[model samples]
Target chain A: MSQIDEQLRTELQRQGVWVTSMQDLYNWGRKNSIWPLQFGLACCAIEMIATAASRYDIARFGGEVFRPSPRQADLMIVAGTVTKKMAPQIVRLFNQMADPKYVIAMGACAISGGPFKQGYNVLKGIDRYIPVDVYIPGCPPRPEALLHAFMELQRKIDEQKLTGADKAEFLKPDQPSEFPVPRFGRHDLEPRANPNVFQPPVLER
Target chain B: MSATIETLEAMERPPVSMASRLQGELLEVSMGPQHPSTHGVFRMNVALEGEIVRKLKPVFGYLHRNHEKIGENTSYLGSMPYTDRLDYFCSMTNNWAYALSVEKLAGIEVPERAEYLRVILAELTRLQNHASLLGFLLSDMGAWGTPLMYAFREREKILDLFESLAGSRMMCDYMRFGGCRVDPSDEWLAQAKQIAERFPKFLDEFEDLILGNEIVIGRTQNVGKLSAELAVNAGITGPMLRACGVNYDIRKVDGYGFYPRFKFRIPLGEHGDTYDRLMMRALEMRESVQILKQAFAQVQPGPVMNPKAKIRAFRPPVGEAYGHIEAPKGELGFYLISDGSPNPYRYRVRPPSFINLTILEDMCLGHTVADVMVILGSVDIVMGEVDR
Candidate 1:
């Protein structure tokens, strides 16, 4: 089959005739209806509520159905500080989520532990355990910032290939859906960071 | 219900060989750590016989980031922003409580204009907190997001005021030791006054929607009853204590800040049940509006910060001081002991949510598992403060 010219494609679209690949249709449906898990951890969770609420209505982007169960949710917004004690439970929740799930580390705390990084109980970052798709940075990022990150996630989803070596990770059967849940050791969480998920660059002074 | 209570009591204090007379096995259920309605990361270990909750134990420290430990490690000025994360809802009040403690320790005097500004901000914080609490309580009762959306619609206006003046919507670290960080413009004050003027209408609209609803009344009226004696004995404060018909608001008792200058009545409730607790917040929001009106009227042009008070390298005297304020939730107090150093020798927060949760089991006894959610919502335990 010959590739359709841009002018011809435009003419077809104007006439209500649409041309789209299966990958485009799949990504379009997935991106538009990204249902977030109804979970809140700390201060940033309040801002997350604000984003979901009336004024910042996350429903505008079709990402408003905040499912209470991980099985029904497509997005896991780790929306606040992840403490050492709660890290295992968070990881467990993530593992319970179905394939084609994405994680949004929704605050500085979720991204790099924020200001509470110095605290003994605070996990340095949630990315230490599970793979995070989007990282929004702020003490507690405003609702507007959260929406921006959501759009960024959508854009990333839009670019995913259907059939190729670099196809979406969720499409790969060998890709692990679950990560290791850390345990509470004497001083810190056992296996401080997941070797597979986290790779911090070496710093030389 | 009386028979159920009797059976619950009998189960609590089993008589000799009563185990043989007792019915089926009690099922132990842990309700949280990731529940939709536990508020935030709070866990309740509940033992149930059918639908009624027989035994309840609240598990804590899930969201704990060692707040006090962090406060102790950081400098006096450095800990201010962290206070915003404590209650999360009433950051202004948390900042005031901590600042009040540090000022008491250092013996710094807050200016008149600054005091007025603090009053205005605190009352605004109160209004938003109560509105959202009611919304959350209703949502837990299965009203879901309609009421919460209504609450947030009003909350966004107040947050706009905060974002304009204090620089952040939720995390407003605007209070310094002796005064506020920035002075609000006359335009800001006018906008706040307009919001205050319009708040009662929202309350009226909210009441029309929820107050007389059969479902709300049925679910909340007799559920989670707390006796006046138990409330006082368990060290309950804020709206929870007032819900028990106690007239012990710290704003009136301690006369901290400009509260004594303003004329506002403390709303009291009878029956001390979930409905009373819910109504207490509604009534208190009305009182807070009155306070805001007065503070806005009396506020004059002057320095927002006290010139004598130091921000960086702030070291209070070598003595301990405990200062408390009537935060939206309850009596939020901060205790600090300075060692003539930048960081305090000891820093402790007497979080209202944590202390208020002490009587969780007592209130939850004999109630249904669903009622437990409503009761916990009435308690309003923000996990950041509860676990911190």
Candidate 2:
């Protein structure tokens, strides 16, 4: 609608030529249309739902489409307490997500296991297994806090370069795209590639 | 525990090849730890014969963060926030339950004003919780977020009040051992009184929207009936028990706090079906409004906390105490063992959600798989409490 845009379009149409960086277009598309998995783990999940509700609608940021299936989603908002029982499933869900996916560690629990950090069952943070794009801090962050994390994630996404190993990580066909899903065994088994964790018997039999 | 259709097929192929009798066998399905309908991180291993459920096994601990273990290791005051996460929707009642246990352990008496404040907040919590339940129950039945949004609208007002009072909406660790953390200013009281007065109009609107729906009635009525005797045997308490026509309410039985001073009725249901469970909550919200009105009016000038109550390094006598209260869900109790130390020797929470869910398989015995959600929703198990 602007004068320069009309001229550029006409000129580009006439010449059948356009100029733009690959990374800019890719990041622009990814940043604006993040689809969060329709997943919630604990107390912070309530706030996450509140954000999805009418008051602080995440749709404004194009993050409201909560895909029940992880395969369809691009963002995983690790919303609440990740216990040992849930850690494997969380890893599986993350691995099932398609290439070019992002994860936002949403609260104190997902960031550092929160007040439950002292507990035996809690994982210290989710990033020990999966890469995190953003970390929002609060016992359970407010809806606004989550929105700020969204901004932070968007900013991080915008900073990528279409060169170097990072570029190959996103663009290459042969690059690895999955992590070994943790499994239940004698003690909980970590994903094969990740270091094994020691289970401390915190309570007496 | 959700497996994609692809994964489900992959799962079925191996088992189906081994068994030739498909006509007489039950299909096993795992629903949730990450479902939209389990309320929170809860999973049910359901075996189905056609549409009817043959067996139900709820596999929990997915949300277990060891609340009691951490509480036992921390200072008395440090555990308040952890309690909020257990039954996250009913944080006020959770706070009061733990505070009551500590108060009992220390033999510390709460002031009149604080008792009145606790009653107000607890009742408000009940109103919001039941409202939320109704919203979610209807959603589980396949109506859209219209009812839930309206419920959230009412709940958001209460959350705003909580935010003003305790600095956080959902996790309000507002209650202390002998009293509340902050006394209500006159302005706060006036606003709360206004909300309490206006809440009935919202309830009337909610009742109008939900009570007459044919879909709700047909789906819920006589769907998941639990007999009174069986429910009692299962140790099922709270609204689930009341729905079976049991007259037991901890407020009336134990007479904790100033419950006896306040005049209110316990809403009981005739049949222990999902419909009755739903009605019990709506009816109880009316009763909560009654208590709130009385509590707000009767609150007088007094110290919020007893003068002798200390904040830190609180040492109780070497003994144990079990303090129970009629939380919105059911009988919420805290069992604490003190060794005359700053930290409790042992801390155990008698979570109502966890106990109420004990009857899930019993209730789901003959019902269709669809009704399982209704029964579980009716039970209202927050996994934070269940797994903790």
Candidate 3:
């Protein structure tokens, strides 16, 4: 019965009626092995560290392999307030990361500039510049909340459609040519390439 | 015999030209606005001549959240949580400092019991901050996370107590303008006392593990010297200054809260090198334990906040006040100007790390590149505090 079951399964795979498509396998592999970059910008970074520590143990979700280098990481957990000064570097790091990469903006600051929203220096939201896959909200969200975000990212990956070559722009096999890196001006990051989009309204008398 | 000894010293050192003596070109190295060892986005631009560092410059503002500016924008009560992000490690002390200034400005009085509670929580914050400082110091020393994890283990217990009382772990935001947000039960205080009693034992074990080790000794001793005179002139306060044998703790001088009654020694270091800074933190934790024990005993049953003061709607007269405390890092001060308004006329944080970081180049010169990490770790500048 064991041998027959094995042969039947193999034959089923050989025919059109199989376990799953190569796309599903690829998605599954990418989803489970989501390696995050070791990046922290502020108070939330402490919570991130606690999550990685013994008690919370992010290793359970396969995110324990925190790559210090962006080149090796498949995910970026922007763990704190991304300020105007730090925004360019954050975008640069995102640009450096390889394909099939995902970005999870993980805190109030990352989500919508947080308690420091009134502050001029803090960026309004990370998603305003780079594309954000998921956003976790809290004034430095608890580690469990971040873990939940990771789970949501996993679900998002599981739900992706990848077949017939009509792929999502983000799902394209080729690495993005370049993320428009912002340059520092007098007060803020000027995405000069996309001028009109980010320009503030001119005050009228 | 003196002439012969002088002749021998001169023979040992060949008289070389000053140009030849300083021959090698210096190499520039940027440690971080983002790197593992700089301890949260602090940048140290260094000039290295061969292995030895010729100059160092600390560049901050990467993690600046515009804390002072935001403080001015928000109401006095709204600024409490922002203080938590100041040092990020010593949230309790930061909250207390901010609250103390607001209380002074508004002429609001905190109840007697609230002062004891503040002392109790402040000591606990010191314990945890110093514990994690040890962890980070050892991590910077390249022991990876062995001692670091042990320190975190001890810190986790203190954080658990905080989480139960304050709702958040790192950013407690529990302090109010009049008093505090929550008062722990008898059971909670008893448990906190238990943890405080157990801290000294953990400190002892921690010291036995890494304090006297040869590698720690070699890397730390007689390295990154900041003389007591220079420390005073540079406005360096807290453990870094105290580590230089200057017993200038604000708790003792200003005698804030119940610090006057408590019995604790101001631990000082002879050399003020990296080793002394590490040892000073270890010693300070013991002092905090003693203070916590006293607070646990003396914390009497009374009202937590003054009945006269309305917390939600507080408006102060036209005046300015500066409230300061011996934060675990250094002297954290909050200067507030009130023009009889709910919002402060101007809000300023005299951040310890930001001021303390001015001496980085002074400390790092004449040491090797590796010692740069040692010195920076010794300084213990949280990028949040420095840039804020």
Candidate 4:
């Protein structure tokens, strides 16, 4: 008690109040209940099924329950190649989801279009339209790899200690950044004087 | 049998007027497009008469991504991965069939080691698919999760082997035109051998679990009995045809790769019923184990992929070829036409499941609507391949 009082007095002198009883409830909740939306588009969907099945058991991390609706889901596991035609739909779906949602772009197609990079229909990357929290790099990332993504998300959640009530603002598509564009052209250049009188003098001579 | 539509019309007097008048008597049921048991996005328009199916017309194209068209558009190397997506549950077999066809077109030879590995992987893929399909059949029969879980557990071990060897799991795309993607690493070889070694005991356990069970026999035996004539007419092959007492295995008949070198027995069935098909798959799994064991013992470690071959945007000489394999389902054939381009001009998949559906009406004619699902499951159609 005497030591606590002495430490409290020193801390109080340096700062205002030492409130040391704040529990990491926000992080814990975010870590334990990351609900992924059911958004499978192509071959990666098979691997996604394999991950959710008994062998990989994605349920162990509490994220195996896939929510069909985006509004209820906290995570979006994009499991396949998104075509150009499908990109707007994906963006619209992401926009419909509530705030505080994270995205894990699964497979190379979602990451950077994989082998279909040159294909006219394939999107270059899903991240161009929707923000990705994690990128699983594989042709179709193994189920265990998907689990690692979940674990990484958990680690991120813990590190950030993000509160449920945090009112984070989303950036608009047209909004300019705070950083200024570099000015290469200067406004200090002076205009040159004309030499028309010299030519007239030569002609007179 | 003739088409059910014609038969129903024949039954009515002044058919067109009767058809117009007697519309609501048939109970319409939409079975799929999202129903998990259909194996993919297939929709069945079943006209039923009080739980007895009168006519069932299969509707497809829900999962059709124009895989064949894409195959036509992409080069030989580029098209390899797309083959994996067709009947994705048994991707290695699909990969080999396509690769074999392309290899045939190019007049390329696969090395001995690569051939052995192909056989080993193809057999393993067969075993796993049959086991999984059996489990699925059981699920359709109301033995919900136990059998499916057991099947998946075995599948996981195989997939693990695939992952360690191929650098990817489900969609392996490991087969190249002339050879495979890579030789088996020492660790992978050891693991594959171990899996083969451990498989017989697991198969015995599987037999004990379901084969002797009275409920399984009662549900499956003498159900949907298709004679050898009917099976052949319907273009059934692989285990389904062999089960009907026909010894027409592509490996034995065509003598592909080192299949002629390996000594094995083909399992046959007398009745060609659902029980026979289930039993056929089980026995084939055992045969596959033997093939795997033989391959492991005989195979010499060497290059897995093709050497002195540059597959980048390579065009084939103008020709047409149909390559068929005795896949786990039936005869899976690729009819390819090359116009001296990087890609095939026309690509067609002679899907065994789709053709096998030719006999479905015959099987389901007198059976109940409940048995219809069972029959469909027994056929084991992969809609990706079917619609493609």
Candidate 5:
């Protein structure tokens, strides 16, 4: 897509690294088996559970196994408000996991602290301590939104061809930050002009 | 008198031994605070003499976050989503209880259509929860994911219906105090109607798969048996009470919402054991399906939300009330104190999981460790509700 990206790809290929054109492979793998650690703190955790149940069916995307130990997990889907008291435990969990870990800030509270940002006990943003791959922006995102975030994460992972080195990029302290809050609804705090529904108008055939 | 009492004590202590003095050689072991099947982060210090439990003392507060304190700070509207966090399994029931309480305090009237919609959603929520919970119980029994997958398939349909109406599937936050936040379009209603029609077939399929299985029956029946008197004393309601042969469904006795309008039989089981609990839930799901059918037929197209109620920065008058719903687990009640402000003065959740847990030791005293999990599973304690 870009000249530098092409050059990088060719350079990597020249170095005897196998280049697979199936760009969605990473996404496919991530999508099928999202082994989440069973770590929940507050209200948002219920939403996380709801996501796992019959209706949202997180199992469809292959994240059904809610492992208790941090070592057995692939994605750390942080589901509730992270308090200062619990910060070290979270850091420890993050540290314990094997390489190629992805963190999904599952609710508004986790993403820039949501409504609890003003509170003294709440952490400002989880990114302050650990790097976040995706931010699901909602007071508490529904299971569907979480599934969407997972799909999006898969796409990003596949497109980048994120191997060990790309994972290392995130490990560096001075690396550029890319915590874009995934947009699912209107950005405006106020209700939009089309209050009847949130869909763009369908044009006539 | 003191000398006589000492003489009597000396007369009674003829065959004393160190082993008998040490609590009949009962083995004391802690089962939880980390065990998988206690539901939440709950610890039970159990003293057992072989397979029979001598005593059990429950240890809680590990998952406590002072939910009431947080509710005091959140506004009436803000607390709606917070309610969804409780009983994370059946969020609709949680939302309804909160809305009902606030509405009662504010004296806001919900429209008939809205009431019908609420009933339909609540019943659907009940059906989905029971199905998923049964699967969870089976998993606890070592059946693993087969049943859970089946339950999830049906649950997906219900959630899709919720998604079509509300923007979110699980934490719907769809029900407001006066009425619903959004109306179901014709398409959504049709989907619900379809689900209602086909649900029985799915249940039939489920029955074929697991209900009649000899293994399930042997594992569940006559295990963790509780008498009707004990169940009532424990304040258990819904399917648990029904399992104990009490016909007291809150929907029947304390008629609220559109439950009064619907005609359905409350199913009761003879034994209040794990098997009966499962059977009661299964039957309750059938009843919910019927209620859905009736609700769908009677539902009239109109405004879902009450047009007259001004909900902007919702503020309720100063009052206190307890609102309870016959949730899938049991009676989920919300106790709210509003001091003429947007936010509640004090809010407490009568969490069914926490309340039903009062009799865990009673249920597990004579049962094996494996049966303890099965019984806990039948109680259907969601950690969110238990912890909150």
Candidate 6:
């Protein structure tokens, strides 16, 4: 099917007709009902809960169904400090989640270990293991920040192409659904970071 | 009819060999690290005889980020923000506990107005902590979301108060060694007074909704019963200790902060069961409101921070001091050993949630698997504090 012209589509809609593509319809359904995996690692989890509660009411966006099980979830809000001890389990949980899953690293800690970055047991960032789609920066970002991240995720989902060279990451058969779960090594997480998922820039001085 | 009678007789006579085979075999079940009801990354290893928990061992260190070690490495002032994440629910109390220890170590005196602000903030923290805890406990018992939403609705009001005064909702790093970071304006004080006055009405509504409900009573009453002797022996403090009819509140005992000036009663419970523990928090929230009212009324205009206290490069003299407070959960104490350095030589946190878990197994042993969640919820262990 050819792309509908904006003017023509508006004219048609005025004349009691509507125009939409299969991709648009699919993305519309997927974007609105993104079910987050109900998992919390630390303080950010409280803010995440506040976002879901009455005042913030995340259900307004149809993303309030926080599934306790990974299989039922489409979004993983890694909402707090990801310690080295919990990193393996978090990765395993990410692997357990079905295809077409998105991750929102919802705090400074989840993004780069935040204030506890200097701690021996803290994970540098969750992106070292599983790929994160959105990163919210705060010790524990306010609920409004989380809501903004949710909307940004929705926008990303809305823009996902069904069939094209620049399609969604999950759409590509070559893209791996499961990443390697890190192990607790002598001093740190084994293989400190995943080469496939995380690529840190090297400095030459 | 004869065949039916024979089958009934067979059913009455349990299979002797089968019973013998199953008698000594116990099933071990690990309940967390990712469980929604564990209230964080808390885990329990349970050895079960059928459905009853024969043995329960709580597994820790899932969320441990080496907080104490980090405190030791960081400067005295640098660690204030870190303390906010300790309980996460009651950051004000955590701040007070840490600041109290640092002050004792350095022989610093808190300003008069700062004491009033601290009292008010701490009480507000207690109100929200206990209120939200009940909601969480109920959620754990399977009445999910509605009670939690109601609790958070009220908690948001308190959080908004914190945010306006300190500029952060949850992580309010508003306390310093000798005083609070920000002084509330007169308008802010008026708003706080309003919230304090309105809190009891919400509590009344909350209690009316859940207190007399048969399901709540059935699930919590007589479940996870901790004896008074065992409670004291295990060093259980805070509402958990008070729930066992113990009158050992750190506020009353230590008489630190301007609590002696405030007229409030510690609500004690007769039975140390899950129900009593739940009620203990509710009653304590009421007491907190009373304290808030008294503090707000007595708060006078004065400098919030002490003039002599330095923030940037705070180096205390060589000494050690342990300062504790009646945190919403229990006795939140901070121990500091300073060696005339900006950073403390030793920094240790006496986390109530960690010590309170000593009796977790004892309370959960005879209870069913489902009861374990309720008991754990009543105990209210935040993983951040417990694992830290």
Q: Write the per-residue lDDT of candidate 4 for residues B71-144, one digit (tens) a residue.
A: 77777788888887777788898988888888888778888899999999999898789888888888788787
Model 2: per-residue lDDT, tens digit, B60-143? 789888888889888999998888888899999999999999999999999989999999999999999999889888888888
Q: Model 5: how far is A52 from its true place, Å?
A: 7.2
Give lDDT per model, in order.
0.91, 0.85, 0.84, 0.75, 0.75, 0.91
Off by over 4 Å in 3: A1-29, A158-162, A166-177, A192-205, B1-23
| DockQ, cand. 1 | 0.86
How well does candidate 3 reproduce the true complex, by DockQ?
0.56
- The sequence of per-residue lDDT tens digits that candidate 1 reaches over residues B1-388 is 3654664465455333333454556766888899999999999878777888877777798899889999999999899999999999989999999999999999999999999988989999999999999999999999999999999999999999999999999899999998989988999999999999999999999999998999999999988999999899889988999999888999999999988999989989999999999999998889999998888888899998899988877778799999999999999999999999999899999999999998988899899999999999999889999988
Residue-wise C-alpha lDDT for candidate 6, range A1-205, written one tens digit per residue: 3377889989999999888888988999999999999999899999999999999999999999999999999999999888888999999999999999999999899999898889988998999999999999988898999999999999999998889899888999999999999997888899899999999979999
lDDT of 5 by residue, B202-222 (tens): 889998989999999999999
Q: Report the number of the highest-DockQ candidate.
A: 6
Candidates in order, TM-scores: namely 0.96, 0.90, 0.89, 0.74, 0.76, 0.95
Candidate 3 residue pairs that clash? none
Candidate 6, chain B, TM-score (2 decimals): 0.94
Question: Model 6: per-residue lDDT, tens digit, B31-85?
Answer: 8899989989988877678899866767789899889999999999899898999
Name the lDDT value of residue A84 in candidate 2.
80
- DockQ for all candidate structures vs. native: 0.86, 0.62, 0.56, 0.11, 0.13, 0.86
Worst 10 residues of 5 chain B by lDDT: B10-19
Interface Cα RMSD, each model = 0.6, 1.0, 1.2, 4.2, 4.3, 0.6
Superposed on all Cα atoms, model 2 deviates from the true structure by an RMSD in Å of 6.0
Residue B378 error, candidate 5, Å: 0.9
Determine which window of 10 residues in candidate 4 chain B has minimal summed lDDT. Answer: B10-19
- Candidates ranked by TM-score: 1, 6, 2, 3, 5, 4
